[model samples]
Target: MTVGPAEARRLSWAQVRARRLAWHGLAEPLKGAGPADVASAMAGTHAQMMSAAELGIALRMDGATRADVREAVWGEHSLIKTFGPRGTVHLLPARELPMWVGALSALPRPSSPHADGVRMAPEQSEQVIAAVGDALRDAELTIDELTEEVVARTGPWAGDLVMPAFQGMWPRWRQSMHEAGIRGLLCFGAGRGRKVTYTSPRRFLPGFAAEEPEAALRGVVRSYLRAYGPSTPQRFAHWLNAPATWASELFASLEAELERVEVEGVDAPQWLAPDASASAFAVPRPRDVAADVPRGVRLLPYFDVYAYRVGNQPPALLYPGRASERVLRGNFQVLLVDGEVAGLWHQRRSGRRIEVTVEPLAPLSRARRSALDDQVARVGEILEARPTLTIGEVTVGGHA
Candidate 1:
């Protein structure tokens, strides 16, 4: 069954879910895939659909390690460059870092009045760089330790001024690192004692070097489409939090490598892999038998990419008026069936036991409920003796 580009682009929402789940190994993070690889694969699979945090949680990484993956992928420590979209830091993958940075930088400067009284001049940046170099010369230091050293060497002024200075020169620092092919944020370490520590930049692995901006952008764009293709340019633009004009430019730059198609009933054009033939349309079907349901429950961390991939479509479909409100305030771990979000789940741990609370967005037929139960059991098995399904809640329209 040869699938044309148009049909492939016009896949049902279910098909899209199946395709993405298959790419991520849905029920589990693929064996042998580390945090970096998991992140890279998610970005590649969903294209622009997955966020840095989502990828991190899928791989079950902590905050410190998440930062390390971000640095390794995007070659930067912070997500602040140009202020468009949400004006928040996003963990950009390494291969696509340049384009995202460039696109964001092209936007107008935000008028938020540059945080009062926090300014770092070029000379200050140099001093900080020197301090960082010295600290990382032999071994990496936790952010606290590194900050302390910078403050000590540069004086009290450096104490308050270093972070601001780092933020100010972040763009330049990132550009230099990207150009030299030096990747930052390699590994994460435990904090002093049991406290959580911030991820630090490191020269962990080799093989990354700088390249022409256009070349880098092209590679990034291609990778995005490979993982998250069959998506509209608007969705891509929204995902990147970039302007449509910049998105168009990037899309044009990647024209030679991508194929554009219009889904059968949809009016807008979508982009997909050039070689994604009809066979790509053969998405895995939803299981009908209870016994055939895939085992394993995924404890998706807060801000998983699955929700972000469709650019807020999930909220619109599931919660309607409450999408924005719930997403902003709640930390929801959705239950997956095959690939679709079958329900919402919450976890509460007391002592050594972790309780999983599931609330289905839609009324589950008996078969679907049984499938979800199997998934919950699998999750219990993975957690061994530590996590247990203490409560199972199935709600329809807010009551379980």
Candidate 2:
């Protein structure tokens, strides 16, 4: 990539932080945005824990509730539940499914982690994906029901339950279920009591199809950069679980639409999508770099998209002070003050009350402490509960 005064630019870490906060709607709650609006803005919300996903979206909007997120997913059919970035379940905007499918389907599949005998062959894997789509074409089936149909159609071998999960073995065909979702062949259906169900994505938007690979690639990259830029190819790769080499080449392919930039304290160069709003490079105002840099207190739930800066450099940059300890554990709920992770927190809920325990790296100012209270109350509102605050150590390990 070419570097020059005309094209090259630099941003103080403060500028990047402020921009990211506003871009993510954490600077203030969005006024008219819906659940799908927030979901699409963040690319998608990690949804292995659906409640956490609902919280992630709800907490971003002005007075939005968990029920609002659920309605978007089930009642309004505006949000789709499917395997998204890095092959994890996510709540993606239904309107963006074509682009997600095209881009995700292009991701290189990881080699099987199972024993040779337990894994499917190349042709068998394809057959399993196709059968999954066909099985759920018209009906939403729970895991067991879908497994029975897959084995019946793809032959008895597909039902071999050998890969141990938590405790018991899971059906062999289950291994390819996520791949089916990425292929736009199937998606999550409404839960049947306690059981999760699977159905075709086509059920929500009939005649859906992925865009051309190149077009979809360009669209998703732009979408990601809009929410997470001024970023680097490596960080982008890590965010989507794509190879660094692939990200580099893809960025190279779109050179005309991107500009290289430097962030204070970052070793390697970064990239950003250029915009016309403020003309050349559209750099942040000088004051944003050093003063009043997006001050606010936010309680981000587990796997919150804005808090997960995948492969970010200088851990101190985001997870400052004691926050690193929590981040290292990998899944503690995050506490953000002034756009940086300043503490770690968790919540427990009873019938009408929520107990929030916060562990700050340093004593908070009266103003920030008050903001924290407001943030906690907002969390309770989203969950429809009364909130009580406690300041102490969190006694749990983290993983996601």
Candidate 3:
């Protein structure tokens, strides 16, 4: 039987953060590490905004640049852009596509929100999914070309441009793109001029095939726990944008693999597992282990994966300071100090110069202020811009 939280020993949040920081590879930028390594470590680096996502990888990799990231995606074909956790776009390692494909395919999807006229029936949806794969076999096609292929295969109804998108409508068949992506039938291909293209995963991975759902789920769950564990079912559910009940059932099923513990001040229990890198319940004195935990000032781009955490955990437990909230989301660039959200920052670029504004939510020591200077310079290196720092209230409405 799994030990309950009450029976488990308590650890200070500082100790837990130390372990988490090590797991996140935040001690220093990794030398000679490629984009895929960082993506796998992050479980798949968030790529809703490719610029910021590239920065996320560069932050952990030594002397890396944006060109390296593009090369991984479009040149070396080692990373593929596809639907990731919470249905957002991410750059996933091509080698791990089997598990990512299988695990995402197994997740429950809500029925299409479009009205019946714009929505494809279950049978039609299946047909479109199949057609999408067949149309893209060993071929790359833009949205227009793919639509023509799908319409030809599934009939004119599938081509109806009725589903509302950002500023216009998308074809009825486009609704299945998410399923087509995770089903291992489709992935992003090189752009044709300015238009985005789609191609089969087989184009990059010759022997590509999704693993069994059960096995793949286990693999991904282990990866997730390794990077963000000591996490609760609810928090895991939230991170995956999955149903709380589904997460609860998945965790229950993995009881044998997980060990539970209660971090002081956190109302719910967290779970972690043994891995090659560290002990399961071994949060010790700072002197007892390698002191590679997160420290000093770091400027993280918007939508960085480290932003994941529950909102209710006491702010002081993570960010040392006077702060109101912990869950930083959307366009706000993160000013992370010592493994937590210390403030919010934003940047604007002109020619070769970038203007950075940082708002600290807590007090900073003199040494930390000096460190911020170095951090800003590093940001400049990643962005290939000269950075000018302004320490003041970021007046933007959302800190974007």
In TM-score terms, which candidate is top?
A: 2
Per-residue lDDT over 291-319 for candidate 1, one digit per residue giving the tens place of the 0 to 100 score: 24334344444456343355323433423
Any runs in candidate 1 off by more than 4 Å, and if so which?
Answer: 1-9, 27-37, 44-113, 119-134, 152-156, 161-187, 195-202, 263-267, 274-299, 305-308, 311-315, 318-329, 338-342, 390-400
Q: Could you arrange the candidates by lDDT from highest to lowest?
A: 2, 3, 1
lDDT scores in order: 0.45, 0.81, 0.77
> Which stretches of candidate 3 lie above 4 Å from their native place?
1-7, 276-294, 305-307, 310-330, 397-400
Cα lDDT of model 3 by residue, 1-400, tens digit: 6786568756567656666555455656644468887777667888878889888788777787777888999999889998778777889999889999999889877667788678788999899999999999978999999999999999999988898889998888988887898898988888899898999989899989998999898878877876676677887778777788998999889988877776768878777765636432222322232234457577878777244443225555664544435334345777777777788888889999999999888778999999898888888888888999999877775535
Q: List RMSD in Å for every model shown.
A: 8.7, 3.3, 3.7
Q: How high is the lDDT of residue 62 in model 2?
A: 83
Q: How do all models score by TM-score?
A: 0.62, 0.93, 0.89
Task: Compare candidates 1 and 2 on lDDT and give the better one.
Answer: 2
Range of the 10 consecutive residues with the lowest summed lDDT in candidate 3: 280-289
Best-fitting candidate, scored by lDDT: 2
